[model samples]
Target: MGRQCITEVGLWLPSLRPGVEEWQQMLSSLGQLYVQGVKVDWLALDREYSREKVALPTYPFQRQRYWVESSEGSDKTTTKHPSATASSPITELLDRGDYQQLTAMLSEKESLTAVEVVQQLIHLHQKAVAQTALRDCLYHIEWQIKPLDVASEKPSQDGQWLIIGGEVTVTQKLAEQLEQKQQSCRFVKELPQDYSELLQLVQQETELPLVGIVYLNCEEVTSHEEVLSQTETTCQSLLELLQALLQDESSNPTKVWVVTAGAVALGEHPISVAQTPLWGMGKVVSLEHPELWGGLIDLEPSKDVESQMEYLITELLNPDADDQIVYRREERYVPRLVPSSPSTSKTFKAEPTGSYLITGGLGSLGLKVANWLVQQGARHLILLSRRGLTEETEAAVAALQEAGNKVSVMSADVAEITDMERVWKQIQAEEKPLKGIIHAAGVGRLDTLEELTPEVWEAVLRPKVKGGWNLHQLSSSENLDFFVCFSSIASVWGSAGQAHYAAGNQFLDGLMHYRSSLGLPGLAINWGPWAGGGMVTAEAEEWLAQTGLETLSPELAISALEYLMSADQVQVTVSQNDWSHFKAMYALKRPRPLLDLITVAAERVEAKTEQAPNLQQRLEVVAETQRSELLRQILQEEVALVLDLPITSRPNPEVGFFDMGMDSLMAVELQKRMSKLLGVNLSSTLTFDLPNIEKLEKYIIDQHLVGFFKPETDEDQQEESFLETNLLAEIEQSSDQELEGSIDQILESIID
Candidate 1:
């Protein structure tokens, strides 16, 4: 047992000879060899009774999830349309209302007459409409606390724990907790400035097989300046750790658990918003390299750890296939998308007196947000882009100006302080102060997990991570109405082939939370792909559609942005998908606990139907005098519950629902609550049309009639945003700034 003693274990004893007893624990070595599939002679290698004959399970013992491309040789550029889609046979039949043919095709009632078929189709339609309410809006995820029972001993507790962070007291406590369970942990208290050095540090620390890498190096960051500093230090450390771990594929997979105190608000606790971005980063890591990924744990925002500490140790050792876990005092939580509506905040309108700045303003999303600001009667709007305006962009700017808004296009790189400083100088020069900032400028690059080098990390991380910092730093002193960042759903839910993209958006989410924690006006909307423009490529949009996630149309996207201007929450993911189609992606792939929301939502709908009924009939039976007030009271309470406001708070009768804080979350909840109470199905947008208490009550009295709804759609046609073409072309034609400026002015004059 010369080499096998170190490589394979339980073969050599502590007394320098082959013996079974006397505190000679070679359990970690055996576990590493067993998991690695390196078979060892049991009786030959050790004493007869020393080795335990363990029972193996029918399913694989290794509980970690891994995903690969199941749809091999699939086209990224084309959407797979079935019979129900735009060009499908079902569409033609449905559009024409050809009930007889459809009934003949789908039903066994071939003997039925055309009239009967029509009657059957009408009945089917009615049935579908009544029950589709919850199914239509069940993908929204929120956090819920659930108790977990972790056993005293987990069978697969091998390898040493490596905690990478400062010598903070909480980290020390975590290490002690790990060792208490007879596990070894190493402390790498400092990280170097360079990636190679960071990699070297990991190599030196993990000579033996590693059980997990615990990252508890984060501190509470509340200011934008701290965001800049921490992005350089803290964010880089996490990236370096991941890069290093990927390089070293040890015998036993070394999973990473990024722990943060106050990174999340489980209940009514204040959060260390700066630490939240790591969740976004950790999500991508889990997706890109599931083999090296553990889950993310957020302890209660406190130092005195009791049961939360116990829960942490248990979760670190025995994660229940859940990637996101939170522990509050005596309570445990996992994330799931519950059927909550998009939220509404206090009503906020663009100020005519102050200027609004849109960074990356030349990009599609930025331009649209600028146009939206103009629609809100915003007088002076400044658009910041690093690139000189191209011909199409010039035309777009002219159109914005034609709408009687001062839309200035300034050239400045958001990541560079000097460039941002130049732009900031001009912004301060304005007669009116800058009121709001929308950071929409970012680049999208396609790289597989292996392709994500440190340079790639820098390129992708710089804009959102660094640019976000610059904006935060420059405007830290100003009283901004809204400091909105256009984060992406890629960060919230890990996207394939978008590792860097997810990381960047994740940084924005974290930055927003940090700002919000500091009592600043910050909101990060984790948006899905925009339909017509911005960073969405044809291939990407097709992929998104294939996954059942709809690309958010610009009109709809902007309306949401406008509505959530001052939303209560710092970070929120905004996207739409019917769970019917979206759940199929995960069917063959890895488990997503967040998607457990769809199940919960479905159960809730089932319970609602089974538990109670006939609310509307009961109201009619009551005196007509009290009917209006009762319905109104129900609406108020439901809205309040969804918004997380006081249950007693009521919406103003004259003010609009959105104005009184109604978003998709409140909207859907109100619809469900009303549907259950009225004993009839109400559309999800019941509040959207009947926006006030008077309108809502009137509609309720008049049989819960829904009003006309205009969908927020974008141009059917789409073009690639600046990252692919304009930015590159401008970089080559840098000497010709004069032509670009003249073209913009001329375009504006012609429009005028």
Candidate 2:
């Protein structure tokens, strides 16, 4: 293969090979020659000269393997490799060679054999490869190409300020303004009065705390014995400022920015005093004007002012920041769509478009859902998974690209708090709201309840339940439309050995119901045995047979998802018609009859009587004594537990239990049960407050609790105590058995 090393900025890779070990030497040489030292990331190799590491892992068959016969003596010992360490620079470097070879082959008119290429590449000559090596390398590299662009810098949330020209007035004013706004800023301003004293002060105060810079006219500065006296003085002052900032714990150790008005001026004074031998020119810029620097420096701007000042500052201040971190194989490749923008090929319908988010998006269901959504004219599709993609996943991404859909893939673990937070921040930052969530990533272990440990339950439930609920909470954004929680049918119909998985999925289902009742539209897709991709295969079938349920085809499951996505609103109850049907195993708990509940209540009261004093006799005796102080303490704790809201010393109406904004779902359930027990209507409004249990108890006594259970309330007693109509009679009169069921049944029906 033909290759050449090009050192010019933005032009590193060429189509020819050089006959020298240039990796380390290039850095030293660049440090000496280039005004700005070479910028590179250990993780992402930018500038074709640096090596590339595959961002996504490859399949075993797609990677080359070399099995050499054991060498003799010390040579054999040397050949036996030590276990790979995570931080080993050698491992990182060796990995880059694969990318280098592929790029070299790609640059040439005729492809070179893997062995032939490795032999020519002196560092990798001893690395062995079998006959299928070259093909495998190409397969892996196919999805590793990310195009290079300067605009790929991380966007700042702290906001930015830019200084232009030789005037320090605007710069100083801007800094003060930003300071008032509680923003951090730094500036490079020319010192005219007491230059030496000013330098000392800048050195002392302008450390890491510097957030912006103010460039003053060089002609107004003190003179020095340099070639360009005024420019040199300005540069020297900046250097002093830079040193002071680097020294101070608060000041940043970044370059002291110098501003020029045009590209012509920038070219003449290319180097700044703040420039370091390790870091090139510290970054450079030429702007048209100063005032427009801050406002017009947006990446997706419509104006033509390049905002070179902002670009320079970003490059210099960003620690270990480089576009090269994006894994790339060849310099020629370009992404068809911009990473920041979602460009959908199909138009969305007038009706709200259902968007689905898949955690573990780089996995099977995640990828499938992404593709399926694109086909359904989804306005946007988000892949929230770990920061990895297998070789297969990358290829799948490429296929989505060919199909003309935009796909956003990010690294995150559904279970980890930090990962979930990052995902949340990414969504907020990108302004992408998720409508549905498909939690397909979960850990499962076959164990009975006795065998299941807390650690195991937490590990499984974190991703399946807690992770789902966290997403649900975060999805309170108005843009959120519906939440779809993927659960296992095993939750509804318990599996003996898979008690852990069943428990985990059951938690998900319960949360789903809770959210739905609160009026947050959602569903729990209780999946049956899954086939095709995922944790199932022919071999898996044998193990799964221990738990008797017919496995579901992956295609059919996906189709069902598609159907739901298209329907106005879908509530499906899917199960195989065999003995293993999910319905057969779901033994719904029987609801207690009204008469039965009355007996249970009487029994509970009788049990409590052993600890209680005779109220009638106690009240007559207590008329003679003040209330006990102990009663106050007990009442306080009881209030805290029952209300589950912060209590104030004074009765703050806003801090009531219902005023805490408990969702409609929780309010309804609590109201239903209390109404049935006390035979009094309970307010379902989140803001309704009951002063205390004593007040409720007194009201109940006055109303004769049983009388309040009537279908209609007496107008005279309405304000005294509220109660819902007789719920038992309403259900008893229903003609349909399904409709006659209580609140639990209604919830199940909605979910189904």
Candidate 3:
């Protein structure tokens, strides 16, 4: 047998006792064990090993029983006893201090025991390395604690297991398998206060095949007397605790176990009776002790329905599953409902009769919309501007007259009821058949609450809210054919510094709702910034070029106008081109039917999947779709006044192109597009289905929708003037102040 060293004791045994008796006993046992072919080279011991107390003397290298012969060594031999007295300076340092204090005290000393000095330094270095490793582990633990979803693997190293007794047993196993995998073992001890230290010791020994933890007994739980009763509870508690630990996101175990009473149970099992809402979960397999409190087992599901959810749960519970968990996000796919043609039409072919009234006609958008109306079919154009249409108005009027449309200019503040009444009278006396009214008068300002005043609020609200009501009053006359109001998009998305502007716009939105409820034929177009014009242009350009956000362009603005004017629609809110469907669906002030139309309109258009193959067919399609009894009657009157077309002749497609020559296919397509225009479903097949012109005419007459159409006759025009004036007066008399409070209340309800 060879002499056994205590310098490597700390590595082999988790806790190193510095008592002389323990070290001597261990040393003597290692010596006897070495005679039985055990090879011992180094030992790990603490500063307590340097204490002075012994019952025997050393013969240095004699290798006798437990004590060695010190002076009898041949040469170059050194030995250190737990009680050995030192003469060298370095030994003097270790004799008075522990490893750390010794290094600090020996910095100035030299020429000491080389082996002892080097061994102390090595142990000190190992301590530092161990401390750093432990700190790193703690740091990882803290990080995992934050999300509780992250998992980490323990260090993979050899494991050392120590049994404490009169004659203890030491076992060396693969640290990886021992610390993390399904492991089997027995112990005579219970749990301790310094549980982490115990766990750390076992973790350093060997790696477990599955997830593992170490337990220590703080003198109390370690009593052999408590081991029997606690055997089952300890095992149950341990199994429960291990199962719980396995569910921890920081450390997830693949295999589970209960090792006690000289037996090891290894398998998969559910942690508890608590049900998990996992899809396709399987049943739990029973354990042996069914009569006693039963332990839980694993559940397996056959379906893939719960795959992603189950995987997420598993990863969350055991974030330490290496690279097993992944996170990803997907975007929603929403189709855009953009129009094919974007550029405004070069010019329109028709004109409105009598004089046209356009409030805020001096503003950029007001001017543009008014100009477009003139070019379309308006013969009489009236400009009602704040500055009374200055040099710009004169130039615009000249352009209109040159284009063959008459122009009229009037001065009135749209927000003033008196001014509105004055202008209404003047128009009625001078322009007896005033046909159109365009309320483009409005104001927009940017001011925070600190800067906002009652005057500012009144100024913003007057034009859009009060002015809208007043304009409605003034325009509500029997002679007026169309009433159009201009609104802004800021009403939908409240701006930071423009609360007043938003309020004003929202007021207009409500007015639109108000009018539609009254069944008034009106249009309120909430417009986006027009291209190359208005305050929005500069702001939009600055934002896009400098910040990358977008603003509305003219094409989108004009498209909104098209929906408003062409459809005779109200509460039409504009948006950036990308939000066509969304804004039309959600942000607009139109009726429920409008949203329903915007939703299903594209679907209807798609229903007319095929188009006319040729240009002539396309023209025929348009004409046939527009053909109705009412249109035919108007055409008959117009032909008599212009060209003498044979109205009595029954139009027959079978004959040569003489009898109105409208094809059946073209007629159906025409009806589809016309239905979109009329906001009603009018079948184009009516042309072919009701081939009798007289019967078709009666159907159109009986529908009476033509009465709601454009006022064509002199009598119809007169009735409009009467109704518009009376309704305007009535609306003007009714103060809308309650509306603001109601709107706020409703909005609060929505938010709550």
Candidate 4:
């Protein structure tokens, strides 16, 4: 074996830096060692020469070349230009409209580098396209394809998930569960507690790729003060945040889910009152922006946090789930329903021995309540108003005093804490302990969201939001028999042009719940528009009537309140609504969850829709003269209805609607009824516009029934013929009163 000198022959071992000759020599040495029967001890050999571990790259880059030709129809020679690198494979895919593959490449882990490169290219391309389109549209007077003109891409599912307002434990658990499922989540540890901060946060985070936002209810509050603070803070923050998010054009979150306590699902929980405003506002928010809402999830108090969180995550991740309001009970999550509960009586009596406070007491509804209280055996009543005494209010107060109830008129702004404190001091010093309170103070203005200025919003919120809070804080320890808040159906149904009003009333509803939780007597009544004495304007009333809501008679409303006072209920909606009519009006954009409570109306709406075309067609075919006649008849009938007179007593065609005892409310009702019946859009001032039946009939015929029919003779010719006719001779021969009587008789005969 050419006895290998141990010193000259290196040990047969792998080397970090090895040449081919060294490897050959090592092989020769290994052969010699094996032939000489030298048994190699593997464990004894030095292992220190092992390769050092190198840290793996965070992300691997695949150096694949991507390029595209500048011109699509170019020859092979034109494709060789170096400047052609402007377009990449990603841009090519976008140009070809293969978005699915692009989205897949962006989502797959193996193609992360490709995704970054593609995203940059796509962004550049989009910018170029947008600039070109805008420039062309603005300067060239040409129709161009703009960004919004392009088909919208489906929302990316890989964006960061946001968890807002959940308990620390529950949010943490939810985050862990999401991570386990390999989903990316960003937990919002703290949310803005004030409206300004909330608005700033929303503006700052408007560009974040937030796929979803899940809002959990705040922790339970123990004190009434805390309840009011937390509830108002949360609600205001939510309102501002939503307004910001909806207004954001850069990157609005794809979905928003509000998770609250199950008390709202059950329809009453005093401790849950602070959260109820969010529920009401959430419903309106969903209706206002259906595309951004995921759903409302209410977690049962008795359910385990871990399980509820698990179920919540599942629902949040699901894209096809239909239910918008869900309730978690024990082991399963189910859809929630706002079921109507039968009125139940509770043993309670209103003792009129002590003084009672009523805010907005000089308003129409307030006076009615004051009189009702007097009739109910209340002796002392303290009425508060910003405007202490008008002629109308003075007369009302005099009547109440004569009816044997001692009335004190106080002029103060209930929304002002100082004013409220002064009033409370005066009440305590001069009168008996306050036995009851009715918070009926509120202001309503109608304007679209775009027209809502901060001043207008604050004006509407002052009396309702601020006043309710002031009263609740001051009266928390009053031990009163009843703390009643006069809320409105706007909060329940979310009336158009009344967002602020609705939000303000919703806060009152929430405060009622909070009061109940403290074992204090509280009741919130959401009354419909009042027929006789209420703050509702004639225009607003007309709109409400068109939507199938009848004005509640003062007598009926007072009776309902009296009955509600004896019931063991925290909140009640007292309204005589025609669900069928309301549904028909909103058939195209009906609000869910709330509308789900009126399923019976859906069929009626469908039937109305099926019959609507036939009615329209019939009207379209009627001759102009006949159509005018039909409109005149409808006008007469509506006028009769408004006046509470027999249809046979229809007024003269030449007499003005106002002259026939048609006040603003009656005129509004007449306009509403005529508008609905004739399928014509009429303004609240329709009676004022034409004034008399003949002029209104002519205007309707010309504006709505034109081109379908024509008069047999010209207007001048008809007037000339009328002057020469026997009717003119009779009118000229008769006395003025007799002629007027004759005209009335003729009108009556025509209607009959």
Tens digit of per-residue lDDT, candidate 1, span 612-689: 434454344334444555555656555666676665566567887677766544555666666666655554446655
Let me know the TM-score candidate 3 reaches against the reference structure: 0.32
State the lDDT of candidate 3 residue by residue for 78-113, as single tens digits. 111111221434444457776676666433556667
TM-score of each: 0.59, 0.31, 0.32, 0.54
lDDT of each model, Cα atoms only?
A: 0.67, 0.41, 0.42, 0.64
**What is candidate 4's lDDT per residue for 463-536, written digit by digit as tens?**
88779889988887686988999998776666667767777787787678767776788888877677764677
Model 1, residue 54: C-alpha shift (Å): 43
Over 4 Å off, model 2: 1-356, 543-548, 565-573, 580-752
- lDDT by residue (1-752, candidate 2, tens digit) is 22235344453432223764666566555544444544434224334565655322111111223577565432311111212112233334467766664455332536778775554443222122211121111000011233334465554335333343344654566556555555556554535434344434554563333344444332221111231233324433433433333344533322234432211101222222111100111111101111111211111111122323343344333423121111111121211111111122343331224445677677766676666567456645567766566677788887776765556677787766677777777666654455666667777566443344546645655576456656666676646545666666555334444544654565465455545545666656666555556655556554343222445544445545544433332223333222311111211111111111111121122221323332222222222222222222223333443345343222232344445444323333433434534434443321233434444344444553333222333662563343334555564465443453566675676456
- The candidate, 1 or 3, that scores higher on lDDT is 1
Candidate 1 achieves a global lDDT of 0.67
Worst 10 residues of 1 by lDDT: 56-65
Instruction: Give the best candidate by TM-score.
Output: 1
lDDT for residue 142 in candidate 1, whole number 0-100: 70
Once superposed on the true structure, which residue ranges of model 4 sit more than 4 Å away at CA? 1-159, 165-172, 179-183, 192-209, 250-253, 262-270, 301-307, 319-352, 447-459, 476-479, 584-587, 590-593, 597-752
lDDT of 4: 0.64
Q: RMSD for each model, in Å, please?
A: 31.6, 36.6, 51.7, 40.9
Task: Name the 10 consecutive residues with the lowest summed lDDT in model 3.
Answer: 277-286
Flag the better candidate by lDDT, 2 or 4: 4
